[model samples]
Target: MEDWKKLYENPPETGVLFYNETVMDHFRRPRNVGEIPDADGVALVGDPRCGDHIKLYIKVKDDRITELRYKVFGCAAAIATTSILSELAIGRRIEEALEITDDEVIKAAGGIPSGKAHCSLLGVVGLHYAISDYLRKKGEATSGDKR
Candidate 1:
């Protein structure tokens, strides 16, 4: 009990944020950071608390996402998460791509600090919105729209 208390009181040396090598690599040179002209679906989403915005573009071919790209204005966490999300989503089927989540993005980015968890949300939200747009344009029902 005393040891636990002491450990809790005198925690490890940590700063405000923690960014591992993978996170820094993605942040410094993010992947698929651009717009796809004539994109099949496009979506823009933002986080009010962080003032982070992302515009995701997708090109679908034969029910699969042939390409994925995005433009993000945010901190290092947001950028890194989004970059990883794009890489995971591209070349995936619509259903599989739609399943992409913030957790996966964070894991791929080497796990961001809990304080910056919302940064991962920005990317997954953007991807979902774009997929919704694509489904709507195809006259298919989205998970929410299938009422």
Candidate 2:
């Protein structure tokens, strides 16, 4: 845990990531923070270096992502990113959902620290993994790969 006071103290040298209200709110009360019962697809990803883990679940209908849910075990950045990723992906075509970018998520979250920017990949990669799982189960090809 970071020292709250140290975080607030204006560091004349090194910069700090003062989490915006939006990020804090999302982290505190993340959206779609659970599993989908009988999920059509699921993925679990972890950044071994950061010890951050995310488990993503989804339900697809007619080639669209009708539902998305997730559980994150990591920093506030991880939680916030995944929370907003769910909002961005739900009700979109699987292809479109996979297109959700780190920039878009960061914008939706009102910007995260540049240092933690990589955390955004967790959500995007999670979606990719879960969607790929769905495609494989459906006996479909993903990214032009025959399987």
Candidate 3:
């Protein structure tokens, strides 16, 4: 537990200093911090021992993401990544949002502290699974991979 804390909290100063103000703001107060009552798609992803979790809600229209929201419970980077990721997904087509990777989130945030890279993984994978769920529910073919 302590090791995880160190990993999340004791990132090198030189690394975190580069994060953009927007990232920091979102990290401190993540947007869309609640569940969608009747979400068209909802996904929960995390490592239990790592104490990271993210839940995504998506509404697709014409195969595009017309609405997206999320709830995140994790470290700073995870929350920041989740906030930015939801914003990124909202106006994008479903397939396009699925293409969003951890690298892009990190880059868009002006780069996350190196050791915190896994923090973004939760949001990335959560979105992937959520979209997959949506597609599967809609009778679209999928690999049926469950992470």
How does model 1 score by TM-score?
0.84
Global lDDT scores for all candidate models: 0.88, 0.89, 0.82
* Top candidate by lDDT: 2
Each prediction's TM-score versus the true structure: 0.84, 0.84, 0.79
Residue-level lDDT of model 3, residues 63-119, one tens digit each, is 888777888778888999888888778878887998999998888777877778898
Which candidate number has the best TM-score? 2
| Lowest lDDT block of 10, candidate 2 | 7-16
Worst 10 residues of 1 by lDDT: 138-147
Winner of 2 and 3 under lDDT: 2
Rank by lDDT, highest first: 2, 1, 3
lDDT of 1 by residue, 1-147 (tens): 998888667755663246889999999999999999999899999988879999999999999999998999989998999999989998999999888889888878877878999999988988999999998877854444555
Decide which is better by lDDT, 1 or 2. Answer: 2
Instruction: Please report how far candidate 3 places residue 12 from its true position, in Å.
Output: 7.5
Query: For each candidate, how many residue pairs have backbone atoms clashing (under 3 Å)?
Result: 0, 0, 0
Return the TM-score for candidate 3, rounded to 2 decimals.
0.79
Each prediction's RMSD to truth: 6.7, 4.3, 6.5
* Model 1 regions lying over 4 Å from their true place: 1-17, 140-147
